[model samples]
Target chain A: MRHRLKDVAERAGVSVKTVSNVVNGYVHVRPDTRARVEEAIAELNYRPNLSARNLRKGRTGVIALAVPELDIPYFAELARHVVTAAGVHGWTVLVDQTGGGPEQERVAASGIGDHMIDGLIFSPLALTADDLTGLDGIPMVLLGERVDHGPADHVAVDNVAAAREVTAHLIGLGRRRIAAIGAQRTPEGASARLRLEGYRAALAAAGIGYDESLVAPASAWHRADGAAAMRQLLASGARPDAVFCFNDTLALGALRALHEARLRVPEDVAVAGFDDIEDGRFSVPTLSTVSPDKEAIARLAVELLAGRLAGERAAPARELSAPYRLELRESTEGPADA
Target chain B: MRHRLKDVAERAGVSVKTVSNVVNGYVHVRPDTRARVEEAIAELNYRPNLSARNLRKGRTGVIALAVPELDIPYFAELARHVVTAAGVHGWTVLVDQTGGGPEQERVAASGIGDHMIDGLIFSPLALTADDLTGLDGIPMVLLGERVDHGPADHVAVDNVAAAREVTAHLIGLGRRRIAAIGAQRTPEGASARLRLEGYRAALAAAGIGYDESLVAPASAWHRADGAAAMRQLLASGARPDAVFCFNDTLALGALRALHEARLRVPEDVAVAGFDDIEDGRFSVPTLSTVSPDKEAIARLAVELLAGRLAGERAAPARELSAPYRLELRESTEGPADA
Candidate 1:
């Protein structure tokens, strides 16, 4: 049976008002009375009416984390860190999958639904700067790709530097003919574009002329897309010595494609990817990739959101960069001089 | 700015009572007035105070989904489906990770935190039947593993049948010696135990004596655990012609170990797994496993919770069985007479 405040007070030999004061954290309560009330609460197993309390405070102790898809290992791992970080702030996290759709992104951004969250930590795939205008006063922290002048605090690793490092690592392995997968042409593909620019920069630094034909475009960053792109590259007779995929999923797919085509990894064509997800660590020839500091990113995002929710609404949005490192694994550790 | 009912009332040229009537789904409002009010609500993009409304109704539009871990691809994939299924009921899902800790499981099962959810869909790993007593009145639906006489509805695929089918398939490949990975010897390991039982049953059906050394024990169903178990089996000189893993993650790890040992899959030993996760589909030799109808499990769990929330509290808790099928892939489809 659910215990009422009156029952708790009666059990504690105190009045209902005193019990309410104790439950609400009123500082004027006597220590002995508070102890008695707490005992009664424990005995009765009385849980506070959180909805009613939050209603009066005009704040729900819940936040939302919106991502493109939960099935993606990168997002799932990142979300695990986010949930852990959010727990430090005594907040619960509700997840929303936007499926990379503009309409769903807008709905999540606006927080216009029956279950209103105190804030949102969003990793957008489809939303643009224009879509971020007028956000209905819901605090939000942006993750992944940067939105120019977007009205939210942002947290991410330096994608360009990370990608450039991966490419340079491959070039250092004597891979002159390097193919790039996951080049996106849309404006919303900001992160992919940055990585592509990084790849070109590395090629320029190494005095290797960029080949347009070696750059493959994948509309979506999934295994199927990567596999199809790799197949197209092979079918077109582009015998690149190395392939740099935009992400780990794409790289794994490229590996499968290479396997299907009877091309040995690293021996024939070295492969590299970004985002050191768990799958990469166990792949047949373990993947070489860039490992973003996901925990720091998650912690920073939640801290920024907590700051905004804690009456820092007028503070200028901050852009924080987390760290990233290159994980040179079996996928790219080919012959010293092939 | 957050718009109020009075703002919508003025924009629609109606009284506050009429606006409230339309918003609250009172049927007495005129159709034209309702349309005008809805238009104003749209123009203003007003969102109702969900906490306040839910408090008055003694319900929260939020539900909790407590899983052991999200980084595990299986749970991540299942969470994606659950979130989609919960969306159909117009309810938001808050995710909590228990980390397979009994204390954490108890806290989640009790729902004692500040955020009170209307219902919970819990996939427990450490929680026991006794820990489920006196749940503080939170409607719950259990997922994965059967807890006999537990005070909640349960939804899952038949573990025994799925495991038996997988083993039988491996045995059908003209393999005499079969090994099983992921044998847990704990009370909390209900699903693993059931799968182990099915493996034994399959061996008995085929009139093959069970080899004690062929059964490998993994403390956890992670890639590392699976790899270590497989390594132990190989080190102990157990040259089983086939191996059935409890889950895909374990199978993937085992595959990596086999690769390390220079053993060709399905030539020296055929491999099988359970839970046809996305990773399994993309594995080097695409995994052969049981594909549980995850969408159906998610939908049925949500439907049961919705029923309980919609005044079916007295109904006897249901035990719903979801469908499953074996997906034969490159992992197990060896030569005709290997």
Candidate 2:
């Protein structure tokens, strides 16, 4: 015979309501009571029939996570961490890639929340604050950028601060003529724009002229695009002492371009990148980068969403600014004289 | 007013059954009939109320993909491709990382199916064929390794042939004292065992001595583990002309260790790795490695699972041996005379 909730409650010396509360993860339950209920659950080997409960409650016990593209290491790693974190709470994460198109982003956002998932953790690439009107009534946590939706939780690193720090590192290394790649004219409030602002701020602080010509624009955030941007900057005859790429993929491509141009890294042109991907450590003349706590972000996002799902007290919207570590590696260490 | 299915059928000049067939993705309908139904759907803006449909039929349009870990770039990239491919069929992929443990693998497999997901794409790590007993009811496609006990389909690259080809590449370079890293003792059917067997076969064919001392074992598949194994190998007083790492992460770690030891690659110690990750190209000395068509594998897995979900014919158990490319870069290409 299958064990029931009453049996568990009787074994634990708790009321049936208390047992239900513990199973539902009610925050009000005492720790000892929760432990007793858990013990009873373990002893009986009672597994909650989630599907049956979901059927009655009109919930799927699944959440969707929409990212830009996973071919990029940063997003790929982020998705992995998010999936692992969600697994801890017994919630499955459905992944969707928007391919960096505004229409696709909107479609993914609208489609995923239509009874297919209980909530969404969206890291959008194209949608802007203007597109927030259609995203109401959905349980979502925005990542990567701040959307102007009134009351949704958000989890993102401080892109502006991280960029500024990287720029400052290059400046302190005596690289006055530093070029910045990934200068895309995206929608307002996008992470790219914020990063550009930070770069400009760093230049201003260093008393260096911020030349628009030094900002190489890329159409997309791919390695090839970064290479093309670097090539364009080099062809323009503006010999930069250093280059700050928007992300590691672009930085990797830029490094290859520099190698092809017979320009030695740090000795000739210093290079720094963001998002300290695993490959950065192994890259030729290892990359100097800002390492964001991706795992922590994933953990916090999952916990926040789980809290919301259980109908816990309305927690205030949280915007966590994870610390970014500046790794001083071979790429931006500069020449001995400098 | 919301248009009824009957209204859609009448307007499209098709029987209700035919309209239902198109809506449900039934394969029996003719192309012209499907086009008519689709046109009618578009014109009428007939969006199926998935909640109501799910209420009637207890099916969720979600599938689970269980991988060992996404920290491994191969699995990370594979998951990205799989998620994209599954999206084309109006399905979402729920990702689970098993950490290569038998208990976690079993939990992921059973949990996903019990949660009412339509199907699963499982990549088991530690679970052997015997542990898969009593898991026969679900529609699943096994990836990476084969396990008997279910009618579920299997999709994987020929690991033995790929490994042998990579090892042969090293032999062709005239490196007699080649070392193999990432040797792990597991069940006979595991990927590690098969790859090891391939390595042995390649050595035998080349008429080179197989030194058991040269094979270094790693407790896990990570860059740190690779670094430790390489350090141990170097300390053991056995100098190898070449090192064939099991995967790219291990190879990358080995490269780092070699750099610390003041050893030059290709000229002093040639190195090659499997799974040509994007970062491998940017490594200070670009890595020579074997590349698999991960996109093809992802597409095939999604197609197979879709067929099963649609009640299509149980196609023959397919073992797709994707062609592997030997990317010869600076790591394994020494100076002309060296």
Candidate 3:
């Protein structure tokens, strides 16, 4: 049998309003009264049926997070951090995969206004800035590219800066023949474009001319694509002394391809990547990566959303950047006998 | 300005109830009326708010999945699969990490009834049969370690059988003095116990005396823990010709330790693990292990939970065993000299 608020109120010898106030965590309630109400609630096993409570307040204490895909190590790691961050706020996280498509991203963005959840944290793959016009009313914290600067709060590392830093690190070791892998041909290629720009900047800063022939094509930011891109780069006669991949998954795939080709890492080809995933730490040759503070991004996004949900939206759309560091490992420890 | 259902109803030239019927996906509405209502909805950009609708039906079209920790690759991969499976049923998945503690596990299980969600799919790390008592009222599907049959439907791989097969595979390769890592010391370690039992079963079948000295203790099922266990085994003067880790994380850790000790894999000591995580597929030696059909497990858990949410409580709680296979890779590819 289900217990009601009235039953708890009766058992606690308090008004129903008082019990409700205690349940809602109102500060006006006396500590003793709150204790008594909680005791009664425990005695009767009365859980506040969140759906009914949310119906009255239009706040479900849950948030939707739509990412390109969780199967990807970066997204999976991001989702893990987001879930941890949401837990601190006593909020649940509803995860959806957009399959990196505009239609699904739209559905995910629109879901905030349509679903029972409080807000959304979206990391779009295919959705453009214009695609976000209709999603203006929702409480959203955009992750990944700042394709548009309209209404949503944004959290991300300085992609261009981080990429530049990684490329510069490789260049410092006298590696000029650097091939960039995982280049996407879409508006969603915001990461690719920014990272490539950073790579070009580093090359320019070092007075090295940019080489377009070294750019490898990728259907998506995945391991298989990275491997294919590496194979193509190998076959195209564009022999690069170093490979800088967009993400860790791509870099790992490239490493696998190099291993199959009987090339010793950092001896024949130095390697570097972004999004320092766990696998990078455990990989055979380890991995050198631009370690973006993913947990920071997740925490900041949740905190920003919480602030907005608490009706404290008083900014020109609050934006925060995650800190990043260059982690050097065996993969890019420089050429052997240096 | 936000559009309302009433505005759409007026534009469609229909009563609010007729428009509501069409919005709720009721099939009784005439085709033309349905078309008119849909057209009006599209024109006005009216979105149905799910909170109000869920208040009427007590279903939020969202389910909670509580796992030990999403930071673990196995659980993260499992969460991805669960999200995909939930999508097929037009349901959303809210994930919670329990930190693999008894208190956290209890909180996650209780969340199903207290939150604005339908049902729960739980992978408990520190919960026992006794701990799952009050959770019976909430619709739940249990995963991992069949310690007891309880009231909830369960889904998991046949841990005992799978462990036996993997161990038998090692024995067939002329490996003796096999060591086992990640033997949990808590009652919550049902998976550990079942797998250990299967290990003992295999040894008995192979006419090899069970060696208790080879059983190393691990505080948790992690890479670091596995590494520590392997180190302890090495220091204890227990020379094992083969190592069977409880999970991939542990196996990877063991491999790292072995690498540090300059032990050639398969030549010095062949290694195997459970849970064919993606990392295992790409690890240096390409870990040999028991590959449980994780996608199938996730699909079955979602299907089981869907059935309960759909009010289909039938004959005695249905329990299923996930498909398993022994994937022999470079780790157990036999002695390199051979």
Question: Considering every candidate listed, which one attains the maximal lDDT?
Answer: 1
Per-residue CA lDDT of model 3 for A159-252, tens digit only, reads: 9999999999999888999999977777768898899999989999999888888999686877778778888888899999999999998898
For model 3, the superposed segments whose C-alpha errors exceed 4 Å read A1-58, A111-115, A146-148, A334-338, B1-57, B102-104, B110-115, B146-148, B334-338
RMSD of 1: 10.5
Which 10 consecutive residues of model 1 chain A have the lowest summed lDDT?
A85-94
Candidate 1: residue pairs that collide: none
State which docking tier applies to candidate 1.
acceptable
How much does each candidate deviate from the true structure in C-alpha RMSD? 10.5, 6.9, 9.9
Query: What would the per-residue lDDT of candidate 1 be over residues B107-139, giving only the tens digit for each residue?
Result: 677763444577889988887666786556478
Going through the candidates in order, the fraction of native interface contacts each one reproduces equals 0.70, 0.43, 0.36
Shift in Å, residue A162, candidate 2: 1.9
lDDT of 3 at A120: 90
Cα lDDT listed for each candidate: 0.82, 0.75, 0.79
Consecutive 10-residue window with the lowest summed lDDT within model 3 chain B: B107-116
Question: What are the clashing pairs of model 2?
Answer: A283-B284, A284-B283, A284-B284
Model 2 ranges with Cα > 4 A deviation? A1-60, A102-116, A146-150, A312-316, A334-338, B1-59, B111-116, B146-150, B313-318, B334-338
**Per-residue error at A267 for model 2, in Å?**
2.1
Ranking by lDDT: 1, 3, 2
TM-score of chain A of 2: 0.82
Docking class of 3: acceptable
